[model samples]
Target chain A: MSRSFSTSERRVLGALHYLGFGLFLAACTAGFVRTWVLFGNPPSIDPLASHRQYIQLLDRKQDYESAVDRIEIAQQLAPYTAAVDGLSIQGYGQIGLGLLERGHPSTARLYLQRLFLALEQTTELPSDDAEMLDMLARILDRSYELGTGAEAILKDSLLLSLLNNLAWIRATHRSDSIRNAEQALRFASRAADMTKREDPSLLDTLAAAYAEAGRWQEARQTERLAVAQAERAGVADVAISSMKQRLSLYEDRLPYRE
Target chain B: MSQADASHFSVTRLTGRSFIHPLFDYLVIGGGISLIATIVIWQSGRSDIVPMAVVPLILLLSNSAHFAASTVRLYTKRGSFEALPFLTMAFPCVCLLLIALCLAWPLRLGMNLQSLYLTWSPYHYAAQAYGLAVMYAYRSGCLLTTSDKRLLFWCAMIPFLRMFFCIQDTVLGADIGLAWIAPSSLYRLFEPYQAGLDRMLLIAACAAPLVLLIKTWRSSSGAIPMISLLMLVTNTVWFFALEPINAFVWATVFHGLQYLAIVVIFHVRDRLSEPTNRHGKLYHALWFYGWCVLLAYALFFCLPQAYQMLGFGVDESVWVVIAAINVHHFIVDGYIWRLKKGDSNRQVVDSSAPAAAPRVSSPAGL
Candidate 1:
């Protein structure tokens, strides 16, 4: 077919093809240029620049719905195409967490169901796909026990993650007041490791778990480390504020110990 | 011989050539008459299923008889001076009978003129499966003749389509009712979750047949076969991972697209030559049947006229029946024209210059 075209015709068609190819390349180049000029390497990959401020406002007013909505929208568009699926799972998880915070357990269950489904479809086998699958499995396992029907959502990976989270929580969080605080720490720590040691929430959860277990020295150390890591990674504000609050609480109890 | 005598001899040869070429003419004319006669007898006998019951019996017996005759002829013609001629004659008859059997039995199985072969009979469904098998056998024979990778690819996907459709129909719970693709007992398996999956699969499946056309595109060599290979790979992936509903839709669309691709191939060849005074009678006839089936589907749906003209109520599910018929017609016609084109291409290549040659290459035409 290529041979059938005359030399002149070949030249014309080839030119047309190359011209279209050039235009496509130019569009892609222009898109990257605009993105760089506008953002110039943000402190964090927070798609919604105002999300932290909104969360702070929500925390002060205790407006869970507004906080949830901001986080949901931000999470949805956070990742580039390479990381979009992971971000989607994270977005669903955040939605569920917001629902739980608002005391809407039934609604939270529904959001968890979508998360479970998305996680089920995704594979975390390191060779084939991104390692998002393991993190999702851990989240779902916790959700399964917390939600109404345990057996209905008891997926194989979820069960595996449940055992791992429980073991970690038992070893670290031995305190009685926050019995499940150790479990939350274990879940978040394992999730962070599974996500290539990237997520800041894992650090936050571990610090909380240690504090609940009355391991004050370990809790303070973990919180300080978490704040430093978040700042270095450009996710500074939230973890830094939380760390300052924890330090003040520790200071208040220090005089009695001395 | 003298010049006058030589001219007369040449005239006779030319006439003989025309007569032999008119075999298709006789086939078409004879088939039409036989169909009319069958309908007349069918109407006169007119008991439900009984009138149509004889069609299968007659076809089976006649085919069996033809097979026996061909076998006997093959035996009698063995190792004799005149054996070659008899053997040649018997061979074609046997082949023709096999083709006739393939077309007739499936066409007859649970066929109704008003409904256009959409009765929910197991026999008809099985017959479609049988037809797909015949297509596989036909394609295997085809692989020997032309180097078209795309045709070979379409050949490969045919079985996957059969399997997927079989599962789909079962899941969908096909009954005599005119349910096209509603949430029935069959679809309940995945009803709780998403939509649009089936349509995406359908598009992929439909595009699957392009492997053949794209492969056979008039060109040099090896690269074209890749198209067929890619189609086969993608189709295999779709068949395995996708659920039966999506899988079946994909298979159906692939089947439809295969036919449409062949039509495109014909148009491409027709335009390439742009032969003066082109005889499109056969092409037109084929198109007529294709369009007629579509027209029948449309007419069946237009209720007031349908009730007045045919007095049979229409259901939306009748569209499924129409679709099934369309699938059958597409595959059947695709096979016939492909065979014809292959034969003609071979003849043109051998007797004329390469420029005037058809693209197909079958031994019969050669």
Candidate 2:
């Protein structure tokens, strides 16, 4: 059934094959060079870079699953890096909260559990930013309640932030049942020690815990320290002014209310 | 003209190599379904669950071997050098260079290549399904007209078309290189019509084959061969019946098995047909498959470890390397397995059981 090829046709086919082969090689090489010139290092397989670029857009879409996946990939590609942790904290916090809002707390916990399979990877967990305070607090609270083992993987700064937020929430909550002055003081002290009492906000939280415990003298002293520390640390004017107002409230033996 | 007699006649007329041994061909190569099981799976509810760990294991075994089979066949097949000189000689170097470049700059070019592979994968599977369907028909002496072939082609293409509707949704789903890439603005621009389009595609994917069966049955005045129907329905089910991830898992395992079986058969037959060869069928079969398995291990496992030693992450090397291999397999496969260009793959089109003759014209030109 083999058909004999004419000399002319065979020549045409051989030329076509060679032409195709040359075009393919040239195209791939050109593509590689163009990509290098345009992107320097295309984030194609660089999870960390991709995560950074798409984090905002992912959040906007409430695509928490994708966000968590990207975060985990970034984490795998560059473990223990400050940038990876930054992404994880922002991403996991948002994902955990979004999952909760979507009534997927169990799924959220599963994601957290998977992200940090071993506790040893937690040596340099991401620290907190002021902007991430609320997000981390809510996520940590859910973690504790769900017993998701998220705490076991926490870095020192994030753990400190978690303790500070819990103490602040308990000490200043308007609902009496939610307030636990004794537990709040313990948490506040732990958070302050973790930061070596350097963080002005931790000091402010300590003042709240003291006032909630009804120790006005220590509360006033702590509030004054918080104001002085905030000013010394070159904290924002609004934050320093707030610390001063809290100082006055402590003088009146009144606990802060959130 | 009697109903029972006509049915018996149809069954008696359908005879071939089974495209291999009957049981293996039906159960594994036809994809997770036996001769009867294909029919049952077609009626069963789509599966929701996905196998996470089994996928990598299957890919390690089947994907690497099946992919390499085409290349091995191309190089060793008689007259391939003269027929496709550029592909046999220069192409290997090209593939090697491309892989090296991908490994070097994985983030940009490597990542895009991986996406290209992922995107091309289903289309490759669909094309293979169409191919095997025709091969089996020709082997079993079914004289299909161009119209019948057209209907079957569309039926087989349903899966690819469905994937085309949502390539980003179906294939990557944020799995590539860790990016939650935004669908293009054009994708969003079509959002208003997306839901309706999706519904239509899914419905068409599910219904096209049944329509083909009925149309072919009526037009040809006989049942389209059972194995051909099985292939179409099985392929569609692999892509459409199960959830996307689960479909991916099943498709990989069965498609790999199917490819491995057919390629092994061809390799063994070619070696046996050699006048100077002393090897028996079993010897050649085991030899080819054993080497395929070993080579797969070298390509997927050891090579990646070697790359890792040369300072690439295990995941990065494995992911990109496998993607690059898939791209190579898809391209070379088209060349080697082509039924035209003086390569009829007599091993397949002439694959009928010994002593059987065509019911109509010769299938050599199929």
Candidate 3:
């Protein structure tokens, strides 16, 4: 049996049939574009998520070049998703930190400044939106030697903790840096008191601050507690390594090694 | 079973479709609002403008539109009985807009210290009021329902003034001689009954686990799933900001996970409620456990980097953790509970009306 359409039905059917044909052609074109876009890409890769994870992992390993590549890839993905803004900022900060660790101060400064700018752009989001604050603190902490300007701006508890750790770094290096370093240490110690006891990293910063300020006995006690707390948080290896580095610097400074 | 009883059971199963539709609708609406708000905020170019301003405006506009469309749909389907729920939802929508307008007027007119502080006060009230109104809408009750007037109004209206207290503490810490905002001030404002402002939010966030537990114990097959989703939303609000209770986010996550587990049980039993098959229960339990464990691990590991990107301080790790945990709970619990059972119970228990037809569309799948 043959079915005949009413006037309205014929009109609707004609519109839908044409639309479907157009969509089929568009889909074919889209498939071609997608094929070209992923010509040599790995089948299992999510470029954004994978790049972000890789940068974080590489930064942990202090591999600056690979981390930078991943960071660029993450940044490329940012235009597609708002959530990637935070990932890009973190990647840049990590790369900058890695570059700084390798003694490339100028390159590190550029990366850190870029990270800072990215964070600054996003800070007005919400009170609870902490992405900017975290990136800014990390940058300020890692590149504290960049200048006094950063020290004045990053007065928040997290950055202050970073500055306090930087003070310990400065205290052992140059005689001219100790006064500002002492001030930073004091600020960090106050910050530590407001935080929970489980945060071993903050305790380390507090201890480092005290040590740089010539409060030797208090520093030793704090360092011991910090080591224990760090172990509990599953970041014991990093803490232990930083502590060992601190011990060597202390031995160089004071004739008596606790 | 009698033919009538069997027909009722089939109807119960059919209720799932209604529940699923509203949930998908809510998601689409909320997502649309968030996207539009993001664009507006990005374009506003206010040095002091906050993202907090965006979502509410989006909600206010989107809800009003959705309500209008729904009013027409309801009127077409079931006449007259729809008006009560319609007016209740409509009145609140108007009030929210009016409140936002009044609050924005001062800032628009001129900027002053008083205006800045005053502007923030409206947001706090808005959050509480919106919450109350939405609860009523969900419950299919009038504004003067027992939950609002008897329970929520008095409890939320106390205005613990935690923000002021925190500001005072910051000033005092900067200068030891500053006496206006001290720990003693907190004692005077909230001592024995309340946990102080900071801890009060923490207390609220912590309540999610208990609420879930009690709801499950009393009626796991009841409103257990919906309440759990609401808890997740509330936790996200509390933990994301620089609120007093933000520090306790990890603990909040634990409670959320437990709630997620119970919600799973409710859904699985709802799907296959035959009086036999003990092993089915074990399978359901294992599936829930596996999901919770996977989510917990992923959130714990990836959250720090998320915080870093959001321009948050490392201390803000708690917020990311809370957000991830709640979203995970929403997805997992929503899949199990909302998909299994339909609106047969919600439509009856909530208000005997279909005003809550829209709730099924919420992104969080409440």
Candidate 4:
């Protein structure tokens, strides 16, 4: 039953086997020494740095799919790193925004959804930062307008700025398909109430909502109150001027549009 | 020949000089070079070099080329189709699609799927190592008794068991979805015993090979093949030396290379064995390799993009497909390479017999 190898073949096989073993031992030893000298500790991997490098590479290449893939690995490696989480949020946001700009609204929705989910996971963001809230509000507003299924997201947001922005969009959007005066009034009222009627921006949104609903007298009164409060609170002159102009429009029985 | 005679002949025989040089076949496809390569990449301190370049290449080749290549083989050949019934094959495909669809929800099913894949991978790698050990043993003229096979199987499995226990509180602990697969209570209960168990398993794995060597020496007149022993050592190094993540990368690359080399060799040999084929040896070899590469690329890269275009998320679709392919490979390889089987194994392993004709048609050019 035995089928014998030629003597030469046996010699070759034996040599290759020893050669492989030698190479394996040599490479492993060299790798350990090199790694110890360069890295100090073999097990102490800084996944944060690795994550950043992968992100930068993906960013430069504009490979969004790979970026998303690498980010998941990064998240697993350093699940609690603030910087890593921030990068995940930013990466998803960039991809989502890029997709939106490219007219891939449906695909963009997926990325943006992931972006928002990542943002929700981050503990570093100050929940009370009005400007940040306003920026998120604007982004979500645009996402909703693009038919990206962001309406539910906008509705679910409890942030005062986001609610006010939604109201404002409903009141003054250029497209009739998007404008909804009734919804605007409800959102504006809710946002203004959340601020205890103290935020000038929420008051402004309420005024626009009233105007959009053709309630000229209420719109005029609300705009005047917003302008007076802005001046008393030492708000920027540009904002005060805008409020006054809106007041004039309401007084003339015209709804504000942007 | 009778089955016993055929088994003895096949076990004792070296592959012919005409088909593949015995040294190359034994050293490379039989897992020698891959072992060295795995060690080099796994232990190397050049972090900038390995992860940046080597890791990605390993991932692509291992999963896309190697893992998905198995599925490509299943559908490409009529014999494979016969080996795996259509319904059996389609079951996993349908399940994977459902899983992909479930990813759209908030159930953390993707994480669960990843955990399952990760958990199953070590065992899969160990099984392949055990299988290859027996294969090299049979090829190198060692007629291992049933007890010897059992010993080798346990020895190979020890490293994987050590890995499984050690991983309970790490990645597998948090992400594994199925409670039945890795129950939370068991992880908690085993928490104190993990270190001790790992140490015990390591000791057992190290000692089992020595015991095997002695037993084989006594039973088979010192005919124990170095390749079989080396296979066990390779598996041990793969599990013990590297961290889980690095072990995964190293094992995957090495295993993939080993699998790819063997599958391609098997394909070439199977085609060359055919009596009706008029093509030259080079044409048969190239034709088989060319289609494998093309099919691997299409399945791994192009299909994911097409899924995205069809409205699935790129991340979700790609991971789902990859996971599905891996699960399918694990299932298919369980039976596909059994030497006792009469079809593909005979064509690939029994080089002493008359060559069969090339039954499948060549692609347009070759």
In angstroms, the error of model 2 at B30 is: 2.1
| lDDT values, one for every candidate | 0.37, 0.63, 0.38, 0.60
Order by lDDT, highest first: 2, 4, 3, 1
- The all-Cα superposition gives candidate 2 an RMSD in Å to the true structure of 12.6
DockQ of model 3 vs. true complex: 0.03
Residue-wise C-alpha lDDT for candidate 1, range B1-366, written one tens digit per residue: 687445333422222221113342122211222233334434565323334335323322222122122222222222221323322222223322332332233223212221222222222222322233223222222221254433553444443433433333433323222222334565565444323444544455555546543543323321222222333433444344444444333333332233233333333344334456354545643443344333332222221121212222112112222333333332233222323333432232233221232344221111
Alpha-carbon TM-score of each model against the true structure? 0.25, 0.61, 0.27, 0.55
Highest lDDT, which number? 2
**Model 2 TM:** 0.61
Q: Name the fnat for model 3.
A: 0.00
Q: Which candidate ranks first by TM-score, i.e. highest?
A: 2
The candidates' DockQ values read: 0.01, 0.05, 0.03, 0.02
Pairwise TM-score winner, candidates 3 and 4: 4
Candidate 1 lDDT tens digits, A170-224 = 3233343224544555555655565554444456556655665566786667667
Cα RMSD of all models vs. native, in order, equals 24.9, 12.6, 20.1, 17.0
What candidate 4 gets wrong by more than 4 Å, as runs, is A1-258, B1-19, B38-43, B46-48, B51-58, B87-96, B105-107, B168-180, B352-366
